[model samples]
Target: MMHEILRQSLRWAILVTLITALLSILLHAASATLLRGLPLWGGMVVVLIIILVGVVFDMMGIAAAAARECPFHSMASRKIPGARHSIVIIRKADQFSSFCNDVVGDISGIVSGAAGFAVVVALVVSLDFHEGRWLLETLTIGLISALTVGSKALGKTFSIRFANEIIFRLGKLLFILENRFHIRVFNVKNKKKRKRKRGVLRAPRTD
Candidate 1:
C-alpha cells in the first residue's frame, strides 16, 4: 500500500510539474507584453511566482478529484460472489487501475506541456513584435498548443479498449485465487475421509 501511494504521488508530481512549466512560460510572455516598460527578467520572475502558486492549487484539485473517483472505495463495494472474501482482492485491483491511470495522465501531461512550450519558444524567437506584443503572441500559441495536445492524449489514453483490458485481467486473477482456495479445501476434506475409511476397513477385518 505504501509503495502504491508513493507511486501515485510521484505521478501527480510529474503532471503538476509539466503544467506549471507550460503555464509559467505562457504567463511570463503575457506579463512581459502587458507591462512592456518593465525589465524582462523581473516580469518573468513575477510571472513564475504566480505560476508556481497556480500549480499548487492545480495539484490540490487533482488530489481531491482522485479521492472522489477512487475505484477501491466505490466499485469494490459492489456485490460480487463471496463479497466479503473478495473485498481485499477487489481493492487491490482498483489500486492497480488507479496507478495505471495516474501514470498515463502524467505522461500525457508531460508530452503536451513540452510541445506547447516548444511552440511558444519558437514563435517568440521568430517574431519581431514589440516586447508586449511578442509576449501576447507567445502566450496565445502556448495555450492553444497545450489544449490541442492534452485533448488528443486524453482521448487516446482513456479509450474503452484499454480500459477493458485492465478490467479483464484483474477479474481473471481474482477468479483464479478464489478457485484455488476452494480446490485446496476440497482436497483436504477428501484426504481426511480416505484416512478414516482405511482405518475402519482394517479394524473391521480384525473383528
Candidate 2:
C-alpha cells in the first residue's frame, strides 16, 4: 500500500508538471494572439479576464476540497441529475483540486504576469513614455498582483462557505455536458464501488 501510494504520488507529480506547462504554453500563446493589434485597454481587459479565470478555478478547487460526499449520496437517492456525478467528483476531489488549483490556477497567474508585461510594453509604445517605463512596469505588476491575490482570497472564503452547493452545481453542469452533448468527462467505473458505498463524508483514509 505504501509503495502504491508513493508511486501514484510521483506519477501525479510528473503528469501535473506536464499539464501545467502545457496549459501555460497554450494560455500564453492565446494571450499573445489576443493582445496582438489590440488597443491598450483591450490588452488590459484580456489580462483581467485571465485573472478572473484563475480566481474561478481556485474557487472550484477550494470547494472540492471542502465539499462533503454524503449530501451527494442523498441527492442521488432522489434521482437528482447530478448526484451520482457529484459523487465521482467527490471521490477524486484531491486530484480535481490539484488539477484546478495547482495546474490551471498557477498557469493563469504566470500567464497573467506575462500578459502584464505585454501590457506595459504596449503602453510604452502607445504613449512613447520611455522615461516612466520603470514606473509603468511596477504599477502594472502591482495591479495584476493585487487583483489576482485579492480575488482569490475572496473566492476561497466563498467557496469554503458554499462548497457543497458549488460542487452540486458543477456536477449538474457536468451531467448536462455528458448527457446532452455526449461528452464524457469522468469515466467512473464500478470497480469496488459497492465496497465503498458506505464511504464517509470525506475521502477514504488510506492509512
Candidate 3:
C-alpha cells in the first residue's frame, strides 16, 4: 500500500510537471503572437483570463475542503445527480485541494507572469518606447501581480461562504462525466459497505 501510494504520488508529480511546462510554453507563445499586433487593451484581456483561471481554481480548492460529507451521503442515498462522485472527491479533500489550489493555481500564476512579460515586450517593440522602458515593464508586472493576488483574496471569502453549493455543483459535473461520458476522472469506488457495517454495529437493541 505504501509503495502504491508513493508510486501514485510520483506519477502525479511527473504528469503535473509535464502539463505545466507544456502549458507555459503554449501560453507564452500564444501571448506573444496575439499581443504582437493587438492594442494594449487586447493584451490586458489575455492577462485577465489568466488571473481568472487562478482565482477560480483557488476557490474550488477552498470549496472542496469546506464541503460537508453528510449532505453528500444524503444526496447519494437519494440517488441525486453526481452525489456519489462528489462524495468520492470529498473523501480525498486534501489531495483535491492541493491539486486545484497548488498545482493548477501556481501554474496559472506562472503563465500569467509569462503572458504579462510577452505583452510588455510586444508593446515596447511595436511602440518603439525607448524611454521609461523599465518603468513600463514594472507597471505591467505589478498590475498583473495585483490583479492575480487581489482576485484570489476576494474569491477566498466567496468560496468559504458558498463552499457547499459550489462543491455540490462541481460534483454534478463530475457525475455527468462519469456516468454519461464514461469517464471516472476521480476513480473512487463507493464505500457503502463499510458505512453499512458501521451502521449495523451502531443499531439500537431490538431485544
State TM-scores per candidate. Answer: 0.29, 0.90, 0.81
Candidate 3 positional error at 44, Å: 1.2
What 10-residue stretch in candidate 3 is worst by lDDT? Answer: 191-200
- Residue 93 alpha-carbon offset, candidate 3, angstroms: 1.8
Q: In model 3, which residue pairs have backbone atoms overlapping below 3 Å?
A: none
Candidate 3 or 1, higher TM-score: 3
Q: Candidate 2: deviation at residue 186, Å?
A: 1.2
Which sections of candidate 2 miss by over 4 Å?
Answer: 189-207
Candidate 2: tens digits of C-alpha lDDT, residues 1-207: 999999999999999999888888899999999999789899999999999999999999889889999878778888899888888988888899999999999999999999999999988988999999999999999999999999999999999999999999999999999999998889744466445456558867897
Best-fitting candidate, scored by TM-score = 2
Per-residue CA lDDT of model 3 for 1-207, tens digit only, reads 999999999988887778777877786677677776788779889888878988999999998898888987887889888787788778888878887898779988987888888778778887999687888889988988999889999999999998888888898899888888888788756546543344456568898
Compare the candidates by lDDT and give the number of the best one: 2
For residue 55, give model 2's deviation from the true position in Å: 0.2
Q: How big is the positional error of residue 130 in model 3, measured in Å on the Cα after superposition? A: 1.4
The residue pairs found clashing in candidate 1 are: 33-132
Residue 52 lDDT in candidate 3: 96
